[model samples]
Structures are given as C-alpha cells and as structure tokens.
Target: SPFPVHINRQQVVHISGECCHCLRLNNLGIFRIHCHGQRGLIEAKIFNLSVGNHYDIGQKISFQLLESYEQLRQFPLEIFRTSLTILLTAQLRLVQERIRDLIVEEKSGCAIVSFQLFEIAAQLPKNEQVINILRNLIDKQAINLIDPNRRILHAICGSLVIGPKGESIDVKLFSQANGDYIGEFTPKKIGQYRIDVTCANIPIQDSPFFTEVYDPLQVHIGPLPKNILIGIENTLEINLDNAGNVPLEVIITSPSGINVPIKIDDILTMKKVHFTPTETGIHYLNVKFGSDIVPGTPIQMMVNNAHIISAYGDGIHHAVHEKEATFMIETKDMQGDLQVDIEGANSVIKTTIDRINNSLLKVTYIPVEVGFINISIKWNEKDIMNSPFTAIVTNPGNIY
Candidate 1:
C-alpha cells in the first residue's frame, strides 16, 4: 500500500527497504519510485538488495508533493510542481522591501541611511552575513553607483558637494556599530546637496537623497553712518542679522585708538549693538561669530572734530544805536577761520571779530539805527555755537 506524505520544499526524505525470500536468494531487485500528487511516476531509483540485506536512499525533492484534493484532481502534478517551485524560488529570493529614514545635514555633511534586508517571504536569517555584505557594498560602491565620475569630479561618497569653482570635494565616511550606515563630509560651499546609497549591488528605493547646505552663522551688518559729531556723546547703532543661534564677539576701536564700549541685545534673529565714541576720528569695528568673520567686517566710521562750548556778549540782549556793542565767545579747541556779521531793519551794522585765543573769540558791532539786530557767526564756513544771535536795538535815550 502507498501512503501520502507531505513535506516542505527542499526537505530530504530517506527510504530503506530489505527483502526476505522463502528460498535462499543471492540478490533481490528493488525499485524506489517518486510521484507528485496523483501523477504517474516522475522519478525512480533502482537498486539490488541481497538476502537479509537492507538498502537505504536519501533524496532532496521539491514540487513533488500534494497539498489539496482539488489541486490533485485538477492539474495534479502541474499544480504541485508549480506550488513547490514558487516556494523554493521565494526562499532563495533576496529583497530589500523598505528603506527608512535617510537623512543628511548639509552644513555638517553628515548622512545616515537605514534599511533592512530579508528574503522575499519576509523571513530573516539568524545570521546577518547578508546585511554585512550589503553594508560593505553601500560603503564601497554607493557613491560610485550614483556618480560614476566621482574620482574626476571629486564627489564625496553618499553626498554631493561641489567646490566654489565646481571642483571635487573630499568626503569622510563614518563607521557605525549599529546596522545603519552613516557617511559624513564637510561641504566647502553653500547650496543644495544630494546623497546616493547602494546596497548589495542594488540601489535602494529613492536612492538619491537631497539636502541644502547653509552657513551655520549668517551675518549682515547694517550700513554705517557717514558722519559722526565730535566732543559730544555720539551713539553709533548697528543692527546685526544673525541666522544661526551663536554667540558673537564684537569689538570697536575709536579713531583715537581707544576701545569703545559696546552693548548688545538680542531679539529673535535681529541683534542690536550700541557704540558710543568719545574721540573724533576714523573708527573701526570688527565682528565675529564663533571665529567666522562677518561679511562687510572692519567697518569704518568717520568722526568730525568740531563743536561749540559757549557764547555770550553784551550785545546779545540790547544794542545802542550808533554805539558799539561788544560780545565774547568761548569754544572748545576751535579751529579754522571765523567771521561775524550784524544786520538790522533798514540799517547796516559794521561788525569786527577778534580771536582772543584758540578757545575764545571777541566780536564788536556798531548799529546805525535803533531796531532789532541779528548777529551771525561762522567757524570754518560752518555755524558756531549759538550762532545767529538776536539783539533788541533801541535809541540811547530810550534806554532808562
């Protein structure tokens, strides 16, 4: 009697048979037959067995078993063979179903690609030998697979970073103890970057990854004031725009070679610095963000050296007609030429200026008639302190 036995694909079956004859027999003929489902014999092995001897045979067979009665009744041998072939083929197929979380930071040039490899049947092997081989491929040929001219173009493996002049850039690879692979490279330029990865001589899904590289600290200093006054507390305000969150070192030197005190305040991406210059001259400012020099650095500021301290005279309040009124002016380290003028209603007043010292000046004016008189003074073609002095003029007899 023949009995049906079910076995998985690639499973080995062992059969042994021994013959006993009534009469003493030297040898006995034996035939081992294999069939798939209800189909006729598909394979056979013949052997000669001696009396009281046993013969054993082991064979690994696939696509030669029955699974269901319907399949046996229908295409019988064909269905069994097809089912076994499909199972065997699936067991031998290697598939990379999902590649997860591929990330790259352009500024840091760090890239990570994580994926898992398994059989088509979703079966994981106990050993990760296949994963190791795939990792090696990703490490060696990943960049090459994406960029064939990597050597000539200087393309970094797993990353796309070109120099300022489109030159090749060097990239460094990192070893990961985990199953994930990571590649790192410092980009020399700022722009969009792409990373490609390959595993087991095959490109993963969405093989090329993209990212944007930008300067960690982007700085912009506002336009400097063209002119600054001297001798008074003058404030120079500069607005700094910092895109990156980093501490900035700001230094300002006055024209007199004195360090100016600076105050910095942060409000979101905008940074404001207030600088007060004590001396008058050309001032320079240097700004840096973590050792990186800010654009438009070493800004220059011009400080003008001219101001008035005080000015007062007798003619400032009252002036006599046809009489000379004297006035005195005091300045702080005054320089250049000085001029004085006086004018009244329908009356011309002659004015004379005398420099008493570098910091002092005397003015005398004679009014022709009694009226309001205006006194104008200039220093170096510029207005003096308390310039355009007004005076009430009246007849000498009218003043009691």
Candidate 2:
C-alpha cells in the first residue's frame, strides 16, 4: 500500500539507499534522499554509488584515474593559465620599452628647442601649415641658430643645410648682429648628426653659423746665412705678411721646441721682425701660429739680420735714427760734386767723403724736400764694394 502525499505541501521528500552490508544483486534496492524548500523532489542519482570495500565517500580512487582526469582538465587548465600570464608579461615589457624609447627621443628634441610641441608638430609631413609657418619665420629671421656667446644655436636635435642655389635662409633671429657666416662641412658617411643647444637645462634656438678652415700661412726663408757657426750670436730678421683676414698669433719655438708668444699689432698688413739667435749650428727655427694665419700667402721668414748690415755701418752712418738707406756715389777715379735731398723735411745737407778712408766732408744746407735725406758722393772713377763706398749721411741737427 502506497500513500499519496504532496511533497511541496509536506515540505519533505525522503528516499533511502541500500546499506554497504547488503549482499543481494537487485533485491529490493531502495534509494532515498530528503528534499526541502521550493523544490521538494528527491533526485535518485544524488546518492547512487556502487558497493565497494569501504563506504563510497571513504573509497580510495586509483592514482591512474585521478592523474588522467587531472591531466585532461585541471592540469591543462593550469598550464594554459600560466602560459597566458607569461605572454601578457612579455607584452607589457615590450610596450614599456617602446614607451621608454619614445620618451628619450622626445627629451633629446626638447633639449634643443624651448617649445616641445612646436618641434614635434613641425616635423610631421602632413602639417603643411606648420611647414609654411616655419618657412616664413626663417624668411623673417625669427629663428636664431647661434647664441651671442659663440655657441651654436641648434634646432630640435638637427642641423640646417643651405644649397648653392636657393633663397637666402636666415637661421638667426632678427635682433641678432649681422655678419657673414660661411660653412663648408661634409661628413665621410651620410648619417644623422645631433645638435644640442641648452642653457641652464633649457633649450634655445638661434642662428646657424658655419666655419671653414683653409690652408695655413707659410713662412718662406729668403736671404739667410747657409752655414751657421757655433758659439756665435746671430741676429735674425723675420718678415711676416698676413694673407688672411683673420688675425693670428705668431709662436716661435726654441731648441726644446717650446712655443714662445709673438706680438701682432696688425694682422692684415706686413710686419718686420728682428730677433737675436742664441744657438748656432743648424738650429731649427720652428714658427707656428696660435690661430689660423693667412692661407697660401707668405706669413713669416727666418734669416740673419746681421749678414745684411755691417757692424761698423751704424757708427759710420751718424747719430741719425733713420732706417737703412742706399746711396749712389759717382767717382771717375779723381774727384766730383754731389747733391743731397731729404724726405719729409725741409732741410738737406750735402757733404763729401773720402773714397779710400770714407771720412765725412763738409757740406751746406738745402731747401725743402722729401723726408728721405739723399746725398751723392763723387770722385774721378772707382768701384768700391761692388759700386761705391757711398754712405748714408745724418742731418746736421742730429749731430751730437
């Protein structure tokens, strides 16, 4: 006999399963489970299990079956999760590296230009308006690539180049000083070169000035003593002519090759030099310049000033503080008269001198003439010292 009962109204549904001690194969197998709440139906599969040595909950499963299920489900899922984590980490690292590179590049550009956005946006090819604005700025001399302190005013990590034929591009600001800038530079291999202009960690843009180096001025030795005797003091006169516009400092080296400073009053003109040589016997006279001298022009000379003038000539000339002068005396072996003229002065004194002894003779004053005091001595006819022993005469006022 079965009693009809509504599980929902009773709030319970009970099902009973066979105990582990049962022996019959299908002899009255009763499975039972208690159901509650909104759904009161007991499911038969909830408590179904095969009879084993121990109760189903306490049964020990084989390692092979457990390991197979783990490999097919949990183990594979764990491995897949680990692989996904590794891939995500690698992707994050790559993205970080790219971001770092971009930051470095941006910093480099910012170090040259004050406006970061201006430089970055100006580089884009699609920004035609920006390019045009930059062009106009250059034309208006609004951008300066050089500073007043002789520093190169750089753009955003780059240099400017001018072609042979094109509009005059101004890289300097309008308030900058106007001057000529010439640059002729070339790299061995074509590559990008960075230019940076920074002041107090901030960047500034100015004019682009260029410089070139030319052939240095050379020293040509003219008339000098070929053989130098030892233990004798020699006087050397170096003639220097500046061939370049740039002023240069002359450096005369000694026996130890130590450079000594030489004064240059004016570099664009010729200069006369006079110095005494200490050592003899083929001493090397090395001359250099602190700055670049004139290119392809005679800049210096090394020669003995003593060999050109006689040691007794200064005494025979007079008390006149005049430069070395040449005189012409006509003597036909007997006697003759002469005339004298002075430059940059109104006085001229004519005097006769001995041919063999070269003693001074009495003379009178003359009218106004050039500063050059020229005197002519004459005899009958005789050749002395290749031409004549004509000597420079001093002004009467210069007599002591």
Candidate 3:
C-alpha cells in the first residue's frame, strides 16, 4: 500500500487514498487516522489496519482517508472515537462546572435572620471540545480557565435568588483577599430554597441546588444560673419544641481562660447541659444552637470561694470519760458532708452528728478513757474553721 500521509501528531491524519491491502505502524505511541475525501466519490475507507495485542484505543476506530481533490454532499463521520460514551453523556458541548467549586462558609442555621456565604471559584469547562483543544496544544501547562467575572451575582444573570415565598433576596458578592468571589444572602422564610447560580445566562453545574432553611431560634432555653459553687455539677435545660434540626454547642471558659468540657443530652424540647466547675473563680458560659448563639450566652458565673464554716459549743471545752460531750456547727449555708474526728484517745471514742437544720449540726462524742482529746471538725474532708480543738477529759469519778 502507498499513500501520501500528513499527520498532526495525535488525533488527526490527512491522507489520500490510492489503494490499501494493509496499513501497519510499529514501535510508536498513540496515533489516529482522520479521513478527508470527496464524499460519494467512492468512499476512501481503510479496509484492514493490523492491530497488536496492546494498541492505542485509536486503532479500534475507523479513520477516513482524507484526499484534497474531493467534495461530498454529506459526511456523517465528523468526529469519531471508540470511548465517545463520555463525550455524548451530558452532551459534548463545553459546560461551566462551578457548582462543585461552590464553597459555603455559613454563620448559622437559617434562623429568623440568617446569613450564609458561598465562595465562587474559577469555573471549569468540560466537554469533548475542551478535550480536543487540550490534546493538540504545545504548552500543556498554558491552559487557562475563564473567570466568572461575578456573573453569579449579576442581576441579569439569574443571581437574583428567589425565596420560598417568591421573595427576591439580594445577594451581595465580594472578592476575598485570595481572589475568590463570595456571595452572601439571607433566607427570607423557613422552607426549602433553590439556589440556581448562572454564568452568561447558563446555569452552572449542579444548578437548582436545594437546601432546607430552618429557624434555629424557635427553640427556647431556660435561664442560666449566674452563680454556682465550685466542685458542683449543674444541669441546664433547653426546650427544643422546634429546634431539633440543628446541633447545640456549649463551651465554658474557666477564670484562667481555659475551655471546660460540658455534657449534652438529647432534644425533647428538652436538652440538658451539664458542666462541673473545678476552679474557684468567675467562669464564662456560652451556648449555641447551630452556629447561632442563644439569647443567654457569654454569661458570667461567680463561684464563691469555699463557704465560711463557723464552729462553737461547750463540747469543745471539756469531756468526761464514758460521757458524751456536745458541740454545734454553723455551716453558713454551705453544703457538704459534715464530719467530726476525735484523736488522742486511748480507746475508741464514739462520735455522732445530728443535722439540726440546713446550716447547723450537733456533734456529740463519748470518750472511753480520760485524757486530753483532740477534736477535728471537717467538711468534705477539709478541716473547717478553727479545727483540731483540744478538750480536757477526766474520769467519771474525778469529774465529781
């Protein structure tokens, strides 16, 4: 077989057909055979092109042998490739793919007043046309994408977002420091919203995006305590009648400016937030439903330095062997386990504590031997005010 072959490197080849028994190429990379000839003037088709076990997908395609001296009324083989499934899929026309590039930087779950942001990135065009131009270009790295020029925010380009109730929302688009365009808008009502951003009057990829607009402010939280005691675990409840869609975030900062962990319960129109204070000082509390901070947030809580406990009574003055001595403790509205310990006794001294009221306790101790006994009054394992009192004890007979 003998024919004048003109090739343009990869996908196209211009050749005039004289006659063909077999056309073979060896020890080379991918190649394509494009046909140019006078149509209906005896179709210049390659009958037998030998293929190897490992060959380019181009070989599986039938390329027409093109000749200069030819003209045809109709030619159907304008473009041909075996793997055209991808080309014919959404159509071979170049399309703007900016929807996946849409970046959302949200501030809150769509509350009564909600604002959201989306970053419009450089648009990418996809199609067979784009692939064809890229394959032949010399400087492979020189391919540049077309800028959107803020088309998604343009009023005429369909950037005017229609709200759920036919309310038109104004989308404010601005460029960031990194050259990214950001579009901001607020949902006018509580419902589903369709965001169909376009460029050059054509919808971008993933156009007509659907999202649910919810009002996180519908939930109600109970009043938060302004003061709490250190070392105590407290629980705060929130009513979630219409607030279960969004997440609740609570963060507590200690006086030393360290974040404290909090416990959260499920929504029941009821969410219990539990936190324990380890440090004694003022703490800051914050609660958020979605990205929206609840009404009562950044609350200042003062944990009063440990309660002042006062002790007084005749029991601390004297004791008699085998006789009970009495004392009274004024807790000053404090809370904890009341404890009384008696040491410096030869035998076991029986001690009893009776709660007279919320802030007072009666401590009674019966000594088994006579001597000087050491009295220690402690609350929650720590010694109370003026602890380790010394009392004089004598035998029952000597007491007379």
Candidate 1 — which residues are off by over 4 angstroms?
1-173, 176-218, 255-257, 267-270, 306-400
What C-alpha lDDT does candidate 2 achieve relative to the native structure? 0.28
Comparison by TM-score, 2 against 3, better one: 3
* Residues 1-400 of candidate 2: C-alpha lDDT, one tens digit per residue: 5989766544433222221122121122222222333231111111112112121112110000111222223224444334423332242222211111111112212221111111122233222333444445444544433222333332322222111111121222111122211111222211121222222222223211122111233333334433222223333333443222222344444455544333433423444433344432223444333243333333233322222211133322332433333333322222233333333334544433334434333333332432344333222121122222223344566558
lDDT of each: 0.46, 0.28, 0.47
lDDT tens digits by residue: candidate 1, 1-400: 5998998774222211221111111212121211122211111211121111211221111111112223233334444334433332343343323222222111212222222222223345412444444334334543222112222111233322111112233433333343333343444444433333333212233433343333434566664543355654444444433233345678888866778887877666566777667787678888875435667778887666655445686877788777888888776664446667778878667877788877787878888877688887766545666777789887858767
Question: Model 2, residue 145: displacement in angstroms?
Answer: 25
lDDT of 3 by residue, 33-95 (tens): 122321111111111111211211111111111111122112222221111222322332333
- Candidate 3 global CA lDDT score: 0.47
How many steric overlaps are in each model, in order?
Answer: 0, 30, 5
TM-score, predicted candidate 2 vs. hidden true structure: 0.23
